[model samples]
Each structure stands twice: as C-alpha cells, then as structure tokens.
Target chain A: MDMSQYYGLFISEAREHVRKIGESAVQLEADPTDRPTIDALFRSAHSLKGMAASMSFTAIADLAHKMEDLMARIRNGLPVDSSLFDLLLAGADRIGAMIDDLESGGSGRGDSAALIARMLAYSPGEQPAPPDREVVETSPPSLVPPGEPVGTTAGEEWGVPKTVRVKTDTLDSFVTTTGELITVKHRLALLAGSCREGGLHEALRDLGRHLRALHDQVMAVRLLPLSAIAERLPRMVRDLSRQLGKEVSFTMQGVDMELDRSILDLLGEPLVHILRNCIDHGIEPPPARGAAGKPAVGRLSLSVARRKDQVEIEIADDGRGMDPGAICAAAVARGVISGEKAAGLTSHEKLMLVCQPGFSTAPAVTDVSGRGVGMDVVKHTLQSLGGSLAIRSEPGRGSTFLLKVPVTIAIINVLLVVVGGMTVAVPLTAVIRTLEIRRDERGNVDGEEIFFLDGEELPLLTLGGLLNIPGGDGPGDTLAVFVAEIGGRRVGIQVDRLLGHQEVFVKPLGRPLSALPGLNGAAILGDGQIVFILDIVHAG
Target chain B: MMFRLRERRFALEVDAVAEISELLPEYPIPGAPPFLRGVVNMHGRVAAVLDLGAFLGLGTAGRGGSLVLLESPGCSLALLVEHLERMITSDDVGATRRGESRLLPVELVLADGMAGLLDVAALMDAVEKSA
Candidate 1:
C-alpha cells in the first residue's frame, strides 16, 4: 500500500483522538470522579492505540497503549489522586508534542519509556492488552478468511478521510490576478475619460461597478467568522480557572461576526491578554465575592458587535473594579505623572492611566497580574492594528475594555489631497472635518498659523509647509483645514485643496520608506500614480 | 554653510543635509513660539513642520524652490531652499572659522578656503527654536 494514501487519514484520526483526549481530560479534571468522561477518554486512547499499531507507528502506538492501561486501572476503581492527574496531563502533553512532530514531517519519536514503565507498574498482574479486540472477539469467518491480509476494503473503514489543502502560492497567484484586473479597470477608466459618448461611458461605469463587486466578493471568502476565535476561549477559560483555583463562568456572544482571517489572527494575543487580565486581576476571590453579597463564581463576559464598518468587542468582568485613586497614586509614585497632574485628572483619565506601560497598582507580584505589562501591551497591540482600546470602570462595580477594529483590512476609503505637487491619501475615518480658509483668518501669530473654528481657536497647518513643499500662499490663500485627532489631542491640518474620497488598496512602503514618520504606506491611484498613505497616529 | 533667504542662497557644509521635500504650511497657532510652521499633511497624516529660514535670522525665505525637511533628535523643521544643486564630490569643500552671523552661528561656520558644501542639518538645527 502507498504510504502517501494513508497519511491524511492518519493525521485526521490522530487529531480527532487528541482533541477528544484534551476535552475529556479537562472534563475529568473538573470532576475527577466523572465515570462517563473517564470512559470516553479510555475509549479514545484505546482506538488511537489500535489505529497506530495498524499503521506501524511504533512510538505513538506505544504511548497510546500505555495511556490506555492507566485509564483501565482508573476505570477499575483504583484510587485517583493529583499525582495521577499530573501524570495523565503529562501524557496528554507528550501526545500533543508527538502530533506536532508528525505534522511537521517528523517520525514522532519520543522518550516515553519511563511513562510506560510507570503504567505497567500499576497493572502488574494483568497480561498486556491485545492490539485488536475486535478481530479476536468474534472470529467471524468471512471473505478474507481470519488471518489473511484484509488490506484492500477492510482498511478503508478505519482510514482517515482526505481534505483539500491548497498551497499558499496558489492563493498568491489569485491575488496577483485580481490586482491586475483592478489595474485594467483603472486603465479603462483613464481611456474612457477621453470618450464623449454618454452611453458608452455609462456602460463602462457599469462594468467597473460589477468588477469591483466581484473583487469584494472574492476577498470576502477569505474572511472567517470571529467564532473561530471565540470557540477556543471557553476551553481556555475552563483550564485557566481550574489552574488558578477560581470559579470563572465565561460567557461569549456575537461569535458569528465575520472578519478578515488576518485580522482575526492578529487579534488572538490581545484577546488572550485581555481575558487573562480579567481572570487574574479583575475577578475577585470566591470568599471576597461571597462576602460582598455576590455569587461565589465570578462572571466574565466577552461580546462582539458590528458597528457601522467597525467591529466593537467588549470583555467585561464582574470583578473588583479598578480604583482610580490607587492608580493615580501609583502613577505619581512611578513618576509617570506628577502629583499635581494626577490630582487634576478626571476619573476617566485616571482610569486610562492603568493602560500606561509599566503601570500597575497591584500590591505585590503574583503569578497572575502583578508583572505590570498587561493592559499597556493590549493597547499597543490594538493601536498597531489601527484599532483603539478604551477602558471604563467604576470602583467596586466592574471593568470593561472596549476594542474597536475595522471590519476589513484590504481597501480603505481615504480623502485625497494635494500637498505641493504630490497627491496624498488620508484615511477618511481619521479626518474629523475640513475647513476653508477665509481672508479675515489670522494667518500666523509669531509665525504660527492659528485659525478659529466654532468660536474656538485652532492651529492650522499647511500641506506645503509641513512636508517642506514650496509655492504656498503663506497660509493666506483659501485653505482646506483637515482636523485629525492624534494621541488624544485634536490637530488641524491645512491643505491646498481637498480632493474627493477614494477606495485604495494600501501597499506597504518597504524598509526604505518606513523611516518616514507620517507616511504609513502607499497606493497606486486610478491614474496609475503612487499616492502616499499617512499614519495619523505616528504623525505627532 | 549654505542657506536660502527669499531668492538669495548662501553656502553651508554638506553635513547639514537632513531631508528634502515640499513645504507644509501651518496656521498661526496661539501660544506657540515663532518659526513653528503650524502643521502640514505629510503623506496621509499631519505633522508639525518648521520653517528653518524664518526661525533662523535668514529672514523669511518665503516659499522658495523646494522645501528641505530637516531634524535632529530635539529639533525638526522644513527649510525652503532655492533648489538642490548637482551632487558635488570633492576632496575638500574647506571649513571656515566660526562666524557671528545671527542666522549662521559659530558652530555652523563653513569651510573657508574652498566652496562651502551645503550643511542642511546644522542650518535646520540653528533655525529650530523648539529644541
């Protein structure tokens, strides 16, 4: 038999077995005396051992065989203890490692001799279990006659099923083809601009619309529901709760919200960090919670909702809320902020201080939350993804961190503007409002341009002046002032003209252009011209 | 050192070259020091670009040929230069003794015995008042 034919089957079977083992082990740990879960775990191990032996995978077969013996002993009413649980957990870890090795094209070799010896010691009186009980139990004298090599049809029933897996190169090729299609559309638009026939131009416009819709649909296929991420959290919470000796009931909603897979991947760590903070810091101890007239088991809720073009996720914990006064004091002591400034801050501002790097109000270092690198990292991670993290808390009530993320990563709607001779693109989401310069406007006081908007003075900047572009009317000409908020401060930008908005595919400006502070990436416009995209946050 | 005031050009050391781009004009911001050329949109974002010529005593060069974006760790601004000349590679664009010009400080003295190379970075630092 061709070994390649069985590879997929082997992998699928192995993964299913491992997943079952992991789930059941977690369940068994939760309720150590649960006979049903233990029996399920034993059956999974027994099946895996049979499958491995039939496939001639010696190491895996040996490990599964040993695990099966241990399970059998436990099932037979042997006293179970924490040490046995630890050994079982160790076995599970080893099995996971072996699976990883196999997936990576290794032979799955591992040193499980000691583990097998330990298992054998527990079942000293019994003969080693037969490799196949099904065949031995009812010697059904059928077609292939008991001892013959029934390799043809009989093996198919036990074989793993195959699934289609496309190489990344194929995906890349598809992307390149779509990009070319977009470029072709741009060329057509440019050419159509010269034609005067209204009917032909309208037809071309319709074609462009259809093509764009098709492109969007193609991209949407790559988007997966956030449930892919939400599904794993329940198990994670379950395991962490057991380890921390706390009762945490985690609830999730909006798991079906769809987002680009890339964004989902990047979001995992930050989400994990937030969840850990909730379990480790936010949730109060059982005794403390009971004394406070609350349920002994703390509740952690994670939810996702689509807001316009953005996704808002909230992770809330009914734990001891953050104390603003304590945070302010810590900030002052750490020299992050002066005592005067800390005192002057509002409660909201004080709560935000907890997200500052190296800021922690925990009394001492613990395995949980005291390392001081939690919330700040979460904020930075979200910011890097062009998202924002906001925290709202009330003392003794609870805490909630709201994360706002864009729905898609590919195309962004940007406001085009002319700075000197260069055309730049600014994401429309970042722009607050655009103002027109008037004759009576105060151009510059001591060489600084200040303009009034809504009866309040706002500083105005020129596109030419900021980028060192010459040939500007010295802030006197009719200017288009663009207001943008950066680092919690509102800044106004004056441009020579405000071009309309455009949907542009952002392409990263390689290492050569990364050093520029304000420029994030660049995109080729409909006219095949390169326009630089700005990073508003990095501008300041 | 080389500097541009309006249409006039002066020579500086070549070490001063920081960056060159178009200028970003800013509205007069209240309470801000002079020479802070408001703010400008660089690429897709807004940045604070300074006017090197106005900050330095070189007089308001106005908008000249091209904007020279310059920055040190503490100071950054855009200066209007007439136009960037051809790259001159010579063994010696000789150094000059320190001078007392308001715009050209003692540290910005150019090489005297030879045609001075453009010192875009130092001139920007001298003109920058923020740092």
Candidate 2:
C-alpha cells in the first residue's frame, strides 16, 4: 500500500495519542501511585513512537520514544517526583507541537537535545522500595499487581484481535451520495402534487419508503461508536493533571453509544474546554480535599448515552462545586451581567451565568483558568451544531455539564408551514407545540399578545411579521400557532397554515436570500418548490 | 468589467471575477454587518452572502437578481449582483489614485472597472467586533 495515502490518518491519530498522553500524565501526577494509569501512558507513547517512526516523522518519533523510556523507568518501581512528571509533560508538549507542525506541512524542528538527554538519564537499573503495604491495600483493584509482567505479558489471555479498515474516500462518497438523495427526494415530493390519480399516490408512497430507507442507511454509515474518541481522553486527563500539580482520576462510560462523525468533530473542542475547566477550577488540591472529608485526589468522569434520537454526554467532577453567588459577583465585577439582573436570578440561573462570555469566578487569572474565556464559546459551538448545553451544580458537590446533540445533520424531521405564499420548514425537535386560535380569542397580556393553551398563556409572534413577509392575515377566526423554544425562551409563531410534518434534506439557501432572519436554509420539496427552513433560536 | 449597482454602471477587474449565480435571500444574523445579507448555502457548505449594493454605498433599495461567489482565506462567500456585464481586460484602464474616489465604508476600486470589490475580510472583522 502507498504510505502517502495514510499520511492524513497518521497525523490525526498521532495528535490523538499525544493528547491522551497529556491527559494520562496529568492523572499520574495526581496520584503518582496509580500503576494502571502509568501503564496506559507508557503504552500510548510506545504506540505513537512506533507510528511516527513508520511515517518518517522523526521529531515526533524521537520525542515519543524518549517519553516511553522515562515512563518505563517509572513503571518499574522508580519513584517519579513532581519535577520528573514536569519533564514528561514537557515532552508531551513537544510532541503536540510537532504534530501541529506536521498538520500544517511544516518540518518539526526545535532545540530538544537537553530534554532528550534528561530522559536518557532516567534508567530502571534498580527497583525502589515497594509502595507502603497500606497504600497497596487501599489502591483500586484495577491497578496492575505489584509483580505482574508489563506490556504484552498480561494481554494475550483475554485480548480480542479485530481490526476493520475502510478507506476515507469511501466514507466521503457515502456522505455526498446521501446529500444528493435528499435533494432528489425533495424534487420528487414537489412533482407528486402535480400528479392527480390513484397511480400517483401509489408511486409517491413507494418513493417515500425508498427515501426513508436510504436515509436511515446513510445515517448508520456515518455513525461511529463513541469509544473511538473517548478512549484517548483518560490519557489526556492523566497528563494534564501531572502538568498542573493536581490529582485527577478520569473515568468514562457508555463508550458503546454511537454518534455521527460530524457531531464528534463538533464535540471535540468543547469537551476539551470543559475538561480543562474542570481540572483548573473544579478539582480541589490534595490538602483541600482531605480537609473537606473527600479523597486526597479529585475525581472526574465523562459518560455518554443515547436518549431517543439524541446523544447525551455528561462530564462530572467530585471537586468543590461552584458557588452561584461568587459567580454572580464575578459576572458583575467583570461587567458581563448587570448587577440588577444578578440579584434577581435564581441559583440555577446564576450557575448558568458562568457560561456567559468573559465571566470567570476565579479571583485572578492563572495559567490554566480565569482568562475571561469561559463556557460561552462552548455554548455557541454546541448551538451551531443544533445542540444544547445544560449545567447542574450543588454548592459543594461539583458541577456536571450535559450536552445534547442530534445524531446526524444530513436529514431532518421538520414541520412545514406557509408564510407569505412561500413554504417553510421548522425542525420538529425545536417545536414545542402547535395550536389553533381565533382572532377574537387572542388577548394582550403585559403588552404582549398571548394565547391560552392548557391553562397557560403563551407569548406569540406572527411568522409573517417576524420574516417581513407581507399579506399575512391577522389572528382572525382561525390562526395556526407554532410554539418553539430556543436558549431557554419559548415563543409562539403564528403561521398562515400548518403544512404537516416531513423528513427532508435541508439545502442551504443560496447567497441572495441568506439574510432573512429565522431562516436557516431551504429545501426543494417533492414538487420542486423550494421551502425555507427557520433558525429557531434566531427567530425567537 | 461592467458592474451594476442598483441602476448605475461601473467597471470591475476582470481577474476578480469568480463565479456568479442567482441570489437566494438569506436569514438576517445578529451582529453581522449591515451589508451582509446572511449566510447562503453554496454547494453543501454555508457561505456568507453579502449585498454588493449596500456594501458599496449604492443604496440596496432594488432587488438583486444575481450572486457572485468570491474566495477568502479560510472560506468563500457569495455577493448579490444585479447584472454582470461583459468581461473586459484592458491595459489602458486608468487607476483612480488614493483619495480620488469617495471612500465608501466597504468599497475598493480597480483598473478594469470601478466595480466595487467586495471587502469580505473587512466585513468579517466588523462582524467579529460586533459579536
């Protein structure tokens, strides 16, 4: 096989491994006694070194090899103090930089002779005194037994040998075909209206079934188990903990849950930001944890699970939870939120205030946290991917961030409506409910138009008025109202008529019509007529 | 080389020509520049679509019938155009010295024609700043 074809894959995989090493190194520094974490870091380095060597990425190869040797010594019972962990972390950073250079088609070069010499100096010549017996007794059961052979020695018995390799172009083609299919389906739907016969109905039904099947198959092909991404995270936590002089134990579950590839890429950065925030702010120091009746080392866990058509990822920590009052004060001090509003907010709302841009509760900026860039970017990124982020916190019990994202972006279930003679589609997931109202029943409450539904008055806005479309009827004898929620606010949209539900491929509206507020994109329906899709948040 | 802004005509650099298509009205995005119509789907990717008439101080009072897609550093965008006149390459096209032409907030002049070159980078910066 031509090695050139593998360069992209190699670079991506190497970067992942380096990140894992950073995380694992952090965890090892936290405990300095978790042999399993140490072994994991060593394995990551070893694999990365081998891959880099094969790919002829000399800088990455050499640095990973040196780091692996150092880890080998530590794994052989040699005590690694904070300084040694720092050196390992520095090596991890170098590997990361080299990977970045490779990504940009630059030769990785720098002065690293001194660091390489330092790594070489650490030798596993003799084992140090065994860990105290009491420490061993209390260690987690998963840690390697004191005298177990390292590396391949303990894996043959239970290891599964399976590897399936598929060309990247194949996946790319699959995505493209799926996109085209959506367009064709929309065109067919438009044509169905022009045909008037039982034969036309039968043909339309057949086409619908075929399109639905194809849509599901395409989505499945794009879905990958979450473990492929989560596997490298533990290593990352370990390395980051070591570098920052903090102890953090990172764990993950629900690795079998699957998600769209695009979603995984969208999720990567926000998850990193959240993890860094946890280490920098959530995890308390050893002395602090001990004083608070918690373990000396802080614990962080990330779990992913499927809920209906969406995936839920939870990142939780067992450190000192956030104090909403402190956050509110910080927000006011930073001038991010007004003092008047801060005073009136509930605790849950206060906690969410941390996600506001430039709002940091930290007393002062540090190397890791308090840089004025908080969870706001995370929220924006998630929202752009059609997702939401929620925060839950208790005064002293750490914070948990839950991110909900859809499985795929290619095909969506939408509620079709008519405004100003043009067809529009709204993602069904974003719609709260739909109602019919009469003009006489539309009442003004608190200076806003409201409609009573289920004993509650819902605020309403005319879709035509919102989109600047003319010729819309007033809330008269019959009004169709579509209620949608975005960013925690619910708003009712009054449309001329409800066109029912559809599963359509949403094609982005071309350049000329891009500026219409609340319109995300357009789709060609079965009859070849283009229908605009609404951006719920912006519309609200 | 011919440029159409609302009803007025101006010359544009033929080399600057990329691709032109029909305009599709896009949703208004908060914090975007007044000139930015909104993002439009170009192929499968979302591309910011700019209103050339509004961008060049030529009042965006008339409906734009065409779109011109231009390339940027990391991405490309489409600009609404009313009419794309004949392309002209001429060595004698005179240069309007700095300060010779009124400095509109978002227009740049070139030799082939006075067609307003869409300043996408500036527009993006303005958007970011407002954001």
Q: Pick the candidate with the highest lDDT.
A: 2
The number of clashing residue pairs in model 2 is: 50
Give me the candidate number with maximum TM-score: 2
Q: What lDDT would each prediction earn against the true structure?
A: 0.66, 0.69
Where does candidate 1 stray beyond 4 Å?
A1-56, A61-92, A103-106, A111-163, A197-203, A338-346, A369-373, A418-422, A429-496, A512-520, A535-539, B1-131
Which window of 10 residues has the lowest lDDT sum in candidate 2 chain A? A133-142
DockQ of each: 0.04, 0.21
The docking category that best describes candidate 1 is incorrect
Worst 10 residues of 1 chain A by lDDT: A134-143
Global CA lDDT of candidate 1, please? 0.66
Please tell me how candidate 2 rates in CAPRI terms. Answer: incorrect
- Candidate maximizing DockQ: 2
What digit string (tens of lDDT, one per residue) describes model 1 on residues A1-540?
555566666666676676677667766776889998888877777766766666667788778867777787788786666556556666767877887888788987799888766555543344444444311211111222212222232235533435445544565455545655665677677888988989978888897798688768766766779876666576677667777888998888997999866678789878887887888888888998998888989999999999766799999999898988888988999988998888778886788898887887767877756664577887766665567777888777789988877776556778988766567788887788876767568557777778887787676766565555553554555767788865454667877678888777765433213344466556666665667676655454
Estimate the TM-score of every prediction.
0.62, 0.76
